[model samples]
Target chain A: MKLSIDRQIYSDACISKVVYWLSAQYAIERTLDGTIETLSISRNDGHPFDETELRSQCLRLLNDYKLRQTIDDETRDIRTILYAKAFADDENLTVE
Target chain B: MKYYLLPFKFTRIGDHEVFVNEVGDMLHAPIGTAEQIVNRTIEDPELYKSLVANFFISEIRIPALLDVYAERLAEKKRFLDDYTALHIFVLTLRCNQNCIYCQASSRDEHCAASSMSRENMRLAVQHMFKSRSQYLTMEFQGGEPSLEHDLFLYGIELAEEINQTEHRHLTYVLCTNSINLTDEVMATCKQYNVLISTSLDGPSWLHNQNRGKQDSYEKVVKGITKAREILGADRVSALMTASELSLNYPIEIVDEYHKLGFTSIFLRALNPYGKATDNADWEAYTNRFIEFYKQAFEHIIELNKQGHVMIEEYAAIILRKLLTPWCTGFVDLQSPAGIVNSVLIYNYDGYMYASDESRMLAEENDFTFQIGKLSESYENLVYSPKVKEWSKVWNNEAIAGCSDCALQAYCGADPVRNHSTQGDLYGFRPTSLFCKKNKAIIEYIISCVIDRYDELMPIFRNWIR
Candidate 1:
């Protein structure tokens, strides 16, 4: 169920593209049946709230979810993109 | 060994540089050494290459040496073979809002019928069509073009009719406040394909501070939203006039544009002339605008990695010319004097100025470059000695730093702006307010590209190739 990135070149400032890919990978990992533990990560503990209860107290998208939650073991496009951004100043992107 | 005297064409690249053939795409020339004759002469390699390229592409040796990069060399040699006027007539002197640094002063409430006569309009349009140039563009500008709605309508109709009948490629553009764009006006613009440009000095608080009859920012945003819905975002654009207040918080301007969904920004520096000449505060603001421009361009490029496609006009202009073969048609960038020679101005009274910023120099009936009246034909105005003077400066203006600077390749010594600030056409601006700001901005820009180059390589390659 992992994404195939062999033919696809990775690394860009494409945040939306990366996010969507992450979402898809998360879904695919959960649907794979063996990765239930990875998909269960959350920033906020589930709790009930009243109108006065600040919305910030409730959880939203989990940022620290395991990589296996999105991509299969073989796919590294998202990782490549992140690494590229992190190490942006060091490399000459043009193959020349 | 250097034979050619004045008009030096080639610059030395490290020890025998190469270029691609004529008429090909701006295809990257694969670097390779030419099989030269086993040389008996001893000389510098870079200088030798420069000389060889010149003589190779010279008129005397057309067939053999003029094989690669030759036609392109010729094209560059004759950059402005066609001189056409992208005439923008400021149709009205009347504007509703009072902006603090109003270059076209709102002081002239005595509206003077504030509109071009039907007769003058007819003459201007007719003169436009009669030109033998490849492309003709007519842009309508004003305190607010929409303020003179009937005159604008009249002028647009004339432009459309002439283009249809006379059969010339025409680009019709308008700069307005967007306050007066009614559905009728929008419909006419849509039908005729008029590119609409508006002004937004900054965000709500700052914009209202600078320009307000009513809440100017909301009004401008309303105008942009309404017009963009009608004319489409691609055809609708905005410009900013920087003031001291917005200088420190330049990101606010960029963020404001982003909030409004504009994909690009001119980050226009405030002019130091016109009613604004007294505003010494604007110099500080201009510097701030340049600083913000560098930061915003970097931020936008970073965001581009996150999937946003944004370009700053200043960066975009340099990048377009440096990386691509197709020209941006910016007036100042071309080699053969690109002022009144490339674009001219016809004011509302059929009075002409050689450059747009000419009348902005002094106050109370004192202006510099009222070169001719619009009643004169295009041929007459273009060939005038005033224009000849500007064209001569096309090589290197009488400016101080620009004429001698190494980076003149990437900059424009605007004599018109110089003439506006100082008493001379080649104003003492290298030391003045404008030059300091540009030097800082240009150096900062070069650093940014050179710094985070790894992140840029992918994007740069895609754009260049």
Candidate 2:
């Protein structure tokens, strides 16, 4: 099964995570051409592949990860501050 | 109209999208709620207020209550501050009863060279004090620790002698099969106020079948009765393991615990070690255990409704995680993966292991988790290179599949389990039984909260209380 994901819609990190999870059952090969990333996935057990099911699953995961990435990007500084304030010796963690 | 999104994860549970915040507080909303939150289109005033109040969003660039949020996050992980509190002392590997699925890899009753030496016990006690945790739990585990009664007493007495100056609050626990709680063991246990944690796998037929002895259940009941008379009823607790046969009778197991006067039962699953490694299919076993857990949990709830008063311990742990901001002391279900952070094992083989299962792994001569010898410095053993390698994969926040999991806050990472089962410390989460079981059970508990709120909350609140 070949999945061509547009980099504009999903970051490489998001797509990579989806592939990493599927890697347990499938041997996935990745190639990036400009803004398009393709995942050539094959079953590890040599069973017949369901391209539609696989594609839908990947799309769902990509969407979820993209939203998660947005949250991470928006909250990165606050999360760092949160940890620093929680654990670090210095208590003042006001962002200037 | 406009608000900044805080870090949270969402997943579809039945018809609703359940959003869990950074600290594990959950809120159920409509299907497109997360999309609305992210796209700045939340229309419901109540939800908007809830999102802000629950630390899921901020009206300002940084919420004024960020300090409170940080403190809650800190409290959720405060177990790290306590360092290693639960120190397991493996007294011996000589068990009288031969269990069908013995995770401890017990040997014959006459097995020599398989017990902790007195010098090693003394050193282990000294090592326990080295931990700065104000409260120390010295747990004696075995192939039936009662088999080595003298060693057990010596260990407790040695801890007492040293604790005179150390001044730490000490708790002693004896993990024994109730079949052999002799008068001597009972007396020592009484003097130290040691809590007796014994194994009881269900009714007589089921329990004996699991234990591989026809008369085992009769002896166990007799021993339990004896222990309760000597020690208080509250001090004697029993845990049941779901063997292959026991899976056929979840209600029977729960009823057996209730019948024996146990208010709570930890419905434990078989670990992948010792004789339990003989399980033909773990995926099938895990699937069955999930169903078994749900069925038994439903039965427990019904029992509670009947005024029987029973708590399913696994649910209580997950409930405490879900409903409260406090972290539980369950080593298996902790992030930063409990190994040395919350527990350390002093094996009878004169070596220090990362956990109880680590020592069990050593029985098969796989010492991957063996930290060092009892003779080694606490600093050297705890901070050894092996432990350093383990720390790399111990945090679920950093692991691949777990990093993006909607249920990550309620789940934990287990590098030792990963290593033992998957041949690596970083396991494949897609095929992880640990991940599957925890996610299913936690999600089921959440479903109960969503669908049967009024019916189950009273029972749940009492369990956590």
For DockQ, the strongest prediction is 2
On the 0 to 100 scale, the lDDT of residue B384 in model 1 is 79
- lDDT string for model 1 (B1-465, tens) is 222111111111233223222221211111122212112131446644553454322222222332233334434423355555577776776777787777765444456776667777777777666656668888887667777767777887887776776777788888888777788778778887989888887678888888755577777788788888887889998877777666666677877877788877777777765556677665566666777667766676766677765556766666555455555567765544456656666666566666556544322355456667678886676677877776655554234444323334445656676566565665554345556676566555444445555878566554434
Every candidate's DockQ is 0.01, 0.76
Share of native interface contacts recovered by each model: 0.00, 0.76
- DockQ of prediction 1: 0.01
Q: How do all models score by TM-score?
A: 0.69, 0.98
As a whole number from 0 to 100, the lDDT of residue B432 in candidate 1 is 56
Q: Itemize residue pairs with steric clashes in candidate 2.
A: none
Scanning candidate 2 chain B in windows of ten residues, the lowest lDDT window is: B400-409
lDDT of 2 by residue, A9-84 (tens): 8998998888888988999999999999999999999899788998889888888888888989998987888888
* Tens-digit lDDT track of model 2 for B229-252: 999899999999999888999999
Candidate 1: misplaced stretches above 4 Å? Answer: A1-96, B1-70, B74-79, B107-110, B281-286, B362-364, B397-400, B459-465
Candidate RMSDs in order: 22.0, 1.3
